[model samples]
Target chain A: MRADARDNRARIMTAADDVFGRSPSASTDDVARLAGVGIATVFRHFPTKTELLEAVLTLRLERLRERARELSGDAEPGKAFFEFFTQVVSESASKLAIAEALTAAGAVAGAEAQEAGRGMRSAFNDLLTAAQRAGAVRTDAEFPEVYALLIGASRGATAAKLDPAVRDRMLTLIYAGLKPYA
Target chain B: MRADARDNRARIMTAADDVFGRSPSASTDDVARLAGVGIATVFRHFPTKTELLEAVLTLRLERLRERARELSGDAEPGKAFFEFFTQVVSESASKLAIAEALTAAGAVAGAEAQEAGRGMRSAFNDLLTAAQRAGAVRTDAEFPEVYALLIGASRGATAAKLDPAVRDRMLTLIYAGLKPYA
Candidate 1:
C-alpha cells in the first residue's frame, strides 16, 4: 500500500475501534466521518462491516500484545504486570461489546484475530512470569489462573457497573491476593 | 399446608433444583421421578416449569441466606466468610443455569425470590462485616466490591471452564487479595 493509503487505513482502524467499541451498532459511514475519509475509502479498506469489526478486533488484540511485550521489560516487574492487568480489565468491557456485536452479527472472530489473541496471551504470560520471578507475585501463580482471574475480575466489574473508585478497590484487593506473602 | 403436603413440596423443589440445574431442558416428569412423587404432586406444588424454577431459585437463595446466618456465629469469622464466598461461587454455575432456564422460559424471578435474594444479600453483608471486624478481610472492602468480585470470579471460572485445581488457585489469588495486608 502507498504511504497515504496506509495512513488512511490506520486512521480508519482507529476510528472504527473507538466508534464500534462504544456503540457496536455504529455505521461504516460513522467510521468514515470519524476518520475524515470518504465512505469509498472506508469500503476500499474493509469490504464489509464485519470485515471492519474483524480488523478492529485484531488491532485491539495486537495493541494489547504489543503493550504486554513492552511492559514485560519494565524494571518494576510486579507493577508492570499488574498495571497491564488493570489496563486489560479496564478495557475489557468495550472489547467484549465489540466481540458480542460480532457474534450477534453471526461473525466469529477470524483466524488472524484469534492468532493475535494467542499472541496477546503469550505476551501476557511473559509479564506473569517476570512478576513471579521477581518475588513480587506468589510463586505458585500460573498463566491459566491469572487469565481466569482477569476474565472474572473484568466481568465482575462490568456487570456491576461499579464506580471507578470501587472498581479500583476491587482491583486492589486482587492485587493484594496476587502479591507474595506479606 | 399439611405435613405430608409440605414434605412433598420440599421434595419437589429439591429434585427440580438438581434436575433443571444440571439440564435446563429436563421435563417436569423428570423432576417428579427424582422427587419420588407423582406427577400430580409436582404440578400441585409448581403449576408450570417456570414456577418450579422460580421456586427453586428462591429456595436456593434462602438456603444461602440461612447458611450465611449460621456461619456468622462461627468462631472463625474469616474462615466462615471465605467458605461461604467459595460455596456461593461453586454453586453459582448451577444456580445461573437455573436462572437462565427461567429466562429462556420467559419468566422473571418472582417477587418472593427477589425478596429472598435481598435477604441473602443482607446476610452476606453481615458475614462481610464480621470478617472485616475479625481482621480476615481488608477494612475498606465494601459489600458492592465483594459482590462484584464474587460475580466476576464466578463468571470468569465458568467462562473458562477452568479445571477444579486452577479455579481453586484463582480463588486463592482472590482470597489473598481480599485479606488484610500483612
Candidate 2:
C-alpha cells in the first residue's frame, strides 16, 4: 500500500478502536465519523465489521508487542516484569475488548496476533526465570501460574475500573509473594 | 416468624440459591419447583423477581458473615483474612451477581442485608488490624484497597473462568504482595 493509503487505513483503524472501546457495537459509520472519512472509505479498507475490528486489534497488539520488546531489555528482570505486567493491566481494556472480539468471531487464524501473544508470554517467562535466578523472586514460583494470575488480574482491572492505588497495592502484594522467603 | 415458617423460608431460599447458581435468570416457577413449593407460595414470599434475588443474596452474605465470624475466633488474623478473601473469591460469582441485582433494584436497604455486609466488613477489618499489629501484614495496607482488589480479581475470575490452580497461585502472589517487607 502507498504511504497515504497506509496512513488512511491506520487512521480509520484507530478511530474504530476508540469508538469500539466506548461502545463495542459501534457501527462503521461511527468509525468513519471519528476518522473524518466516508463510510465508503472504511469499507474500502475493511470489507466487514469483523475485519475492521481485527484491524483495530492488530494495531493495539502491535503496540503491546513493542512494549514487551522494550521491557525484555530492561536492566533488571524483576523490575521489567513488574513494569510490563503493570502496563498490561493498565491498558487491558483495549486488549481484552480485542480478545473478546476475536473469541466471538472465531477469528483465531491471525498468525501475527498469535505470535504477539506468544512473544508476551515468552518475555514474561524469561523475566520470571531471571528474577528467580537472581534470588529476587520465590524459588517455588511457577511461570504458568503467575502468568495466568496476572492475566486474570488484568482482565479484572478492565471491568472494575480499579483505582490506581488499589492496583499498585495489589501489585505490591503479588511482588511480595514472589519474594524469596528468608 | 414461627419456627416452621422460618424453616420453610430458609428451605425455599436455599433452593432458590441453587437454582440461581445454575441459572441466574431462572424463572420463578423454576425456583418454586426446586424448592418443592407452589409457585403461588414462592410469589407470596418474594412478591417480585427482585425480591427473590435479594433474599438469595441475603442468605449468601449471611453465610459469608458467619464464615468470617468463625474464622476470626480460631485462626491467626493474617490466616483468617487470607482465608476469608479466598472464600469470597471462590464464591464471587454468586456474591457479585446478587450484589449487582441488589444495586440495580435499589432494594438493598433491608436491615438484615446491611447488617450482614457491615458485620463482614468489620470482621475483615479486625483481621487486618490484628495482622498489621502482629507485623505479618503491611502497615501500609488499607482495607478498601484490599477489598477492591479482591472484588476486582473475583470479577475477573468469573469472566475468565479461571482455573482453581491459577486462582490459588494468583492468591499466593497477592498474599505475598500484602505481606510486610521486614
Query: How high is the lDDT of residue B130 in model 1?
Result: 94
* Model 2 spans > 4 angstroms off: A1-5, A23-29, A40-51, A93-119, B1-12, B22-33, B36-51, B93-119
Instruction: Name the regions of candidate 1 deviating beyond 4 angstroms.
Output: A1-54, A93-110, B1-54, B93-110
Question: For residues A1-182, could you state the per-residue lDDT of candidate 1 as single tens digits?
Answer: 99999999999999998898778789999999999999999999999998998888878778889999999989999899999988877775545553343223223578888788788889999999999989989988888999888877777765555787778888988888888887
Tens-place lDDT digits, model 2, residues B53-163: 777776777777788778777547777778878888777544446434323222344666666666767777877787788777888878866665665567555544567
TM accuracy, model 1: 0.76
Worst 10 residues of 2 chain B by lDDT: B98-107
For lDDT, the strongest prediction is 1
lDDT of 1 by residue, B1-182 (tens): 99999999888988888897787789999999999999998888888988887788777778888999999999999999999988877775545563242122223567887788778888889999999999999988888888779777777666566677888889999998888877
